[model samples]
Target: MKAAVASALRAARRVLAACHESPDGDCLGGALALCLALERAGKRVVVASTDGVPAVYRFLPAWERVTDRVEGLGSFDVAVALECADLERAGRFAPVLAACPVLVNLDHHRDNTGYGHLVWQDPQAASVCEMVYALLAELGAEVDEPVATCLMTGLLTDTGSFRYSSVRPETFELAAELVRRGARPDRIYELVYESRPPSAVRLLGLALSRLQLSADGRVAWSVVDEAMLQQAGARWEDTENIVETLRSIAGVRLALLFKVEPSRVKVSLRARDGARANEVAARFGGGGHLGAAGFVARGDLEDVVRQTLQAAAAEVQTGSG
Candidate 1:
């Protein structure tokens, strides 16, 4: 870890950061967390994402500086990719990885392929933000208010507000510490969970309307197509919350949400109880936690629907208690 940090500090004097497309809570939170930390180290920082930052995160410090394409992004001495497994997950900014002298890939996904020169993939760490926290401490960097806000947001979202099994005692302790450092839980919570446009609420209603149950009622599935999105006037970002309602019904152990994109289908997989969702997602080269994972599917929506439904059924039968 010392050698890794040494290499990081040497090459990270001027740094750029990238996250996955259609950024989720962890993706944006982790990248922003590290950018703020690196900036505090007196390094130049440029953070960009292909899918762009969602409105919920616009309040973060230096959030406005994030651009879709980081021009001269290759000129940075080092670049960091967060919360992404594959290098291709960087989308257009992928070349920035090769452009820099050093790359640090940090993620908690089980399927991470060790893409960066300095790789830290700990699936047990719950979130990439946790690994970043450890990295900051390894450098003996101070956790000021900006750093605390970004890290706290990362931890809060990835663990579902400390309601998931990943929430260890240490996680709570860290939360308290962040609060001590001036991270306001109420404001962030309201931004993440409560605030949403009216169109998103309508889209959520439509998604729930399409919810389907397994023959035994142990699995639930829902699909939201582009047409449905257009009808409801919902942006692709608005679909983030569509998956949770699928698992709300009693006895449902597995939930699936299929979001149709322009070229492919994106699948969100969630498990209740002790199911292993990351394993289920890895088949398609995507992953997350045992309870919440995602994958991108090729071909048509029907193909995606067929494959996901089949895979989900097998998981339900085999994963049954």
Candidate 2:
């Protein structure tokens, strides 16, 4: 699959590289790194994201090149979807990708639906960046300083600073190689983790104040509504990492953070070892890694929370037994 994707990319003169809607570090980093590598190969690459780059990720190399609009960009010889479970995960850009003559799906999600003409997926991968690194080698593209920094962001963020169980010996070896190529892990850590605004910190406090645990203490959950965002002067992106915090509580098997939108509630799920957070997410038409997943449901925030918690609780109990 890697060879097939590399061949397609080499053959294409104009390529569209895209990540999922509300992309996190993995998708954005992998896409940008691929974009830089392809450009070096003499291909015209356009990187698109429906929600655009979040402030925390603006430090990535070539971050400014990402455009939220792709409709007016004309046709592409091929489109590459990075870290997207399915084309619909591309948000408004799904149709544009579907229309492309050739689509390559490069992802690391366990529940990937396999939508593209050529698919390369590995659930064990710490991040799609790992796959991207391999692809660059296959294409004989140099991992310059810019490319190294981009790939390193994906590795650090997706592995929770290498704290997650997904990290392997190869993951560390890749990090070392990237560092030798000029990716500064210390700077990346400070920028992505330690540079949160005061508003975001306030939002985190508000969410933590409302954290609730199930009777059995296996499920922990909280909600952040529009009112909280307004009160704390926080944007939706500020809610990042709140679910992981919840999962860190003692005896907690599953953690859920619900962000209440005007018409829908976006729930982020995180689970400890043995708990299938992705299964709970899949129950609601969402999917992700075993330890992390999410879904959006259109309903009252309270109602959605109730339904999701019920599913999560059952999973926790089953895992415990």
Candidate 3:
């Protein structure tokens, strides 16, 4: 994997790095970290994402470098894909990636579809940022302030502040090293967890009020419709982590949040007590980790919710048994 990555970097003078649609911190951080590393290595880099950097992540160093559209971004010698399950997960950048000569897929999701010229995936890694950190070290690129800050944000967010089961001993070791290199945990915590907009709080209230539990009390779900977004003046990004609120309810093993978009319902699923949310997501052509996954369903919101809840309930039953 290192040899392939090194070879790609050596042959590339211009690189394009991108993440998944509606990207979370892990994907964004990994992409940004790699962009910084490549820039330091004297390569021209463009960081692209369909959703761009979320408000919460704008505090990271060089966050402004992220661009939303890659339509006419020209050609690149290599494209680095971070935390994307498949090429389609790149969203608007799919065509741009197809135009590139080489794609280096770096991810840590077991369900990844494995579609890249140079693929390096490790489900065991807590996040793709961990893999990026290792890659930078392998390339002997300096982990400067910008790189450290970006990578640490990924580690903190993906691990749930070191609370998730995916975290290992090495996670902390690397985190400490990043801190030593100028990553500020206090500042990142403030930017990500503590800096919620008022609209988001209102949206959370609407979502919580609509939360419903399954007959067996093992499955829980909520809907954030267009009406709710309009009422609360919240964008879809503000709905982040709302499913975690549902999963926090006592006796709930599987939690789902369905948000109504223009022509699709964005679904976020979370599991507890061995329920594999990824399987439920996969039934609808989505993929993620064991405990968290998501998908976009194009159809009537009510119908999509019904189908998703049914699958989620089945997983809850299977997990309980």
TM values, all candidates: 0.81, 0.85, 0.84
**Which is better, 1 or 3, measured by TM-score?**
3
**How far is 203's C-alpha from truth in model 1 (Å)?**
2.8
Residue pairs in clash, model 2? none
| Cα lDDT for residue 210, candidate 2 | 96
Provide the lowest-lDDT 10-residue window in model 1.
1-10
> Please, what is the whole-model Cα lDDT of each candidate in the order they appear?
0.80, 0.92, 0.88
Judged by lDDT relative to the true structure, which candidate is superior, 1 or 2? 2
Q: Which residue pairs clash in candidate 1? A: none
What's every prediction's RMSD, in angstroms? Answer: 3.8, 3.0, 3.3
| lDDT (Cα, tens digit) per residue for candidate 2, span 225-295 | 99999999999988987988999999998999998888898999998869998999999999887788999
lDDT of 3 at 95: 83
Q: After superposition, how far is residue 264 of candidate 2 from its true place, in Å?
A: 7.2
**Top-lDDT structure, candidate number:** 2
Query: Candidate 1: misplaced stretches above 4 Å?
Result: 10-12, 209-211, 222-237, 257-269, 274-314
Backbone clash numbers for all candidates listed: 0, 0, 0
Name the candidate, 1 or 2, with the larger TM-score value.
2
